[model samples]
Target: MLFPVLALIPATRTEPSSLLKLLAGEFAAQVAATWPEPHAAFLAAPAARRHLTCLALALGRDLPPIAERLLGGRLRHAIRLVLDPAPSGLERLLGRLGELAWDAEDYRTLLRLLAQRAPAKVLRHAQQVEPGAVRRLAGLPEPMGEAVGLALELTAEGVLVLREAYDALRLRDGPEAADVAASGWARAGSGKALFEAVRDDLTPEPLAPPHAGTTHLRPLRSKAELREAARRYRNCLGDRLSDAATGWQAFYEWEGPPGAIIGIQRDPIFGWRLEEARVGGNGAVPEAAREAIVSELALMGVHVGRSGWRLERLLRDDVGRGYRYWPPSQDVAEAFGDED
Candidate 1:
């Protein structure tokens, strides 16, 4: 019964009256709803309900009883910021944090990060990672703050992967974490560069669903493996370890003379598409090797870019790549014939 309209004004503290009105409406609706047993546990708990307001109650209902015990009187301010406005782009994250091991002080740090307006990606990832890990980084006022303030320099690609990679680097390099953090935050530093610099040293997380690699196309499973491949190919494959680490892109090396690397990335539109096939030192991929690579990848249900158009009479399938009206290449065969 709450928020019959999907899009309402965002509940920022811009105007006291407007925020209060919205709060009142939400409260009335929620109070009227029937929450039984554990869902209404907060309402029945020893803690006062003064701080739980607006959509927070909706989030509150889903929290496991342990959260109720740990966060006695009030939900953290950061939790409030993330829970309100209904479509915070973080509703999914809220649902998954029912098991958060809350410390009053830790919650305060989270609040500080939000009040200072950390990037949405950073906040989202913070919620996803271990709270203790966040506490560690939050304590590093020098580099992480520099990392946060100079976001434009480092770019989101670097910050997006910061927490996970930071944790990994801490585990692997230990005392060197400070230097590593500086590498990302110094005026000359960047997130991408930081990742590239320590890609081999950083540990690799297990790929979800665990891909079984072929003899010729073994998936890049470790950062050490990435370093070896990058050296052999003389390509920037090392820079793409984050992509492979996340399983968004799977990097596989061809075991042979004139060695090659194939990048298969998951595409929302096309399941899995062959994004790259590069030879050693970024040389042009030979047609014979290209054919063999494509053939083997196809057997694994992976397709190349816009790759599924059936070969028609007298049309070479490999030469064309584009949508109906767009041109994938300047080749005459692609312009006049089906390319996608």
Candidate 2:
């Protein structure tokens, strides 16, 4: 008997009718509060249970508190009963309710509860429901903008259904549907553009490795060696200079022996200057070398305006005075000296 009743309602049926009977039964039990007697009655007559369930669901806010409590419990029980692989005595009682109608609020509350408590059941039920209702329900407001956006995004196909609804509403009302459609289109376009911009911003650029034939150097053998080298270079230069001061600098030329270059120079104000030095191959000199130079200098704590020729010349002069500190055998002075 239970099997026949379950079979009567197709799995796809989403109308309020299918569950109406069960809902009504629960509501009646709540209203009566007699407990065992009503429960026995519900079990005895599955058709009666079905009618009661439908009535209860339709009652909505009109239902008393006792009805709500009883109905809630019964709803939970019906859900569990439906989960059983084999039809139970309560199965027929679970059926009988035909198609049910749910407004936006009802759909939202039901969906939330389903997502939290019975996700699988919710999905199954959604499939059974009317496509139009499902589409509308999918568009219901979400607590978070992202969630709403995602819902709209996932149900893009449902837009047609919404459009139909809009049309119907418009016929019944005025230009409400047209306005909604326009707003939806505008928002979607803006969101898409914003998403693309963010995506582009996050995309990484391809990194090119150092050019072939470029010289490279490791740092000094130890911090002590580096300090001692700095001190010695400073002594040779005989000047107190800014780190940007090219008279004294440290760098590894990517030519010849490929090792450190330390410069010692005399400054007008500072008696001695020590600086790190670097020698670049012809390839290192760019058409916009000044821009590159300024960019590199900025990275090294040197502040200079983009078009400051005076500052550029000063930097070039200081860099020229910086000497290669690597041993003669390792120096790129000869190999990398070409002006080009």
Candidate 3:
């Protein structure tokens, strides 16, 4: 039992060296208080390894019970988060894990440990939160994984935009992509405006002018923050009321007859990029409504991008039943089947 736990900790205090040790030692002290002198004596044998091993054994025997006590029954849920294949919650969840310690170094160590132990999960998580992280993590040789991991902990949001840039470069120029990307990442600094330089470098361009309303870039902090921004946008609309729902990638809400659509995506430099509100109707958007939408976003401090807002229509389904939200490449034949 102790060997497994011991094996996980680095002898040189590298990677998750600090966090794993701290958690192990703290857990040992807690269990030692409850056990009899003999069973718990190993916990205080005046040597780090002995104590860690003793504690690991005790916790292994009663993991669920101990986890419940430590995490208020949320330990199972947290562990489940670790097992999840999706990359979206890795950084946030890992941070939540070490939040009990409230030390930046501890949080970073835990992050490094998780990535080392579960590279795939870490890769996805970093990709979801900050593509630069995935690029940085991927390009690194084994030794630098931990060091870069620490850097990511500090600039998680700043690196989100790097994913697309890195991916584009990778597609064009395979393994050698890391050299150029890493240089950009090194100069990324605090991540603000980090993507401004690479936005054009992307094969297709991230800030391409939209055919619809003007594209404005608003860097919101979180999904919740985007919703709040949408709410403020509604307030700016004055009396117009429409049903609204916010999703991970975009915010869709009905406002009056024409309705409105705001697209959202992750950006490491600015956090989240929100498109300027667009008229969501089949017909031309009324000038009044367009002004109202643009005005509200501007007042809220969202930066207008390269293009100005314009009235444009989205493609609709045949028979005009509703807007066709799916991409053009979608296989409609497979979707509806040969039965029709």
Candidate 4:
């Protein structure tokens, strides 16, 4: 389950610190105390465990403690998905919620709504409903509660769903929907009007992000294979290949040896638009070369965007830097010599 929050905010690749793991463990335990079934099931899955670990780490201390159980499975599943890449608007909305000084009750209400997978209709109704309804549901005062609740619901469904919802509402309710838009709903970034500005035709479906709990690197057998891969990529890109260099320059500016090797891998953290690659040789892969490779791939539309591959250093002695090794680890290498 990917967090709907991943769509908006960028996830960091840095490994979780011990402190964060501690916090996540405590939170998981608390959630278990209230709703044990989901928590136990969550612990059973390694990938889901990693999701919780990463999110708890990324969210850091800002992650509010779990005080009450609100349909634990949905909450736990959503929480796991929240670590993976998700809809941008939902991610931003979740970020705002994290930033707030949440009380126990606030967490309870928000978690409940998330568990329900609040529909766009909830948001539309939220706007039309009286102040009492807003206050009762969101616990915030009057219009603010209505706005936030609606935004939260739309975010849960993702930006695309939100757009469809708003479009349907406008077609059906007309002024009622307009009235909601006019009533400072746009003040919250999740609101319909604000979302419209950022909305584009790009859909998230085509982007093939790597599966969770997988290695980022894909090894090449030889420089010949590498060149062939590059050529194929260039051919796929055609004229857009020119933009590849520019795309590469946007992220890195360092220089390195010409013969130095590099390995492009999908990022384990962040969105599909971001990546992490291994740079081999005496020093890190030069910015110029990185620019060339990434620019071509990006231009070809192989990656999520123009600037996606994040570069890293490969240890000088690491033979795996430029070669294929199934299982991609020493355990496999020990079982069957390093080379195929």
Candidate that would win on lDDT = 1
Residues 1-340, candidate 4: write the lDDT tens digits: 3677677654432333343333344354433333344343334334433333334434542333432211134544455444344322332233333211233343334434443333223623332322233224443222233355444445333444544544554565575644464344436564554554323111111122222111222333322334444453332212222223223211211123343223223333323332333233223334455555545445433343223222222323453667432332332222111223
Task: Report lDDT (CA) for all predictions.
Answer: 0.51, 0.35, 0.39, 0.35
- Candidate 2 wrong stretches, greater than 4 Å: 1-38, 43-126, 129-290, 293-340
Q: Is candidate 2 or candidate 4 better by TM-score?
A: 2
Higher-lDDT candidate among 2 and 4? Answer: 4
Model 3 TM: 0.25
Give the deviation of candidate 1 from the true structure as CA RMSD.
Answer: 17.6
Query: With candidate 4 superimposed using the best TM-score fit, by how many Å does residue 51's alpha carbon deviate from the native?
Result: 9.2
Q: Of the candidates numbered 3 and 4, which has the greater lDDT value?
A: 3
TM-score of each: 0.37, 0.22, 0.25, 0.17
**Residue-wise C-alpha lDDT for candidate 3, range 102-213, written one tens digit per residue:** 2333324334545564454554454233334444454443323433543454444444445545666677776466446545555544444345445423423123222223
* Model 1 accuracy (lDDT, Cα): 0.51
Which residue ranges in model 1 land beyond 4 Å of their true spot? 1-210, 307-340
lDDT of 2 at 312: 40
Clashes of each: 1, 43, 7, 11
Worst 10 residues of 1 by lDDT: 330-339
RMSD of 3: 20.4
Q: By descending lDDT, how would the candidates be arranged?
A: 1, 3, 4, 2
Model 1: lDDT of residue 184: 48
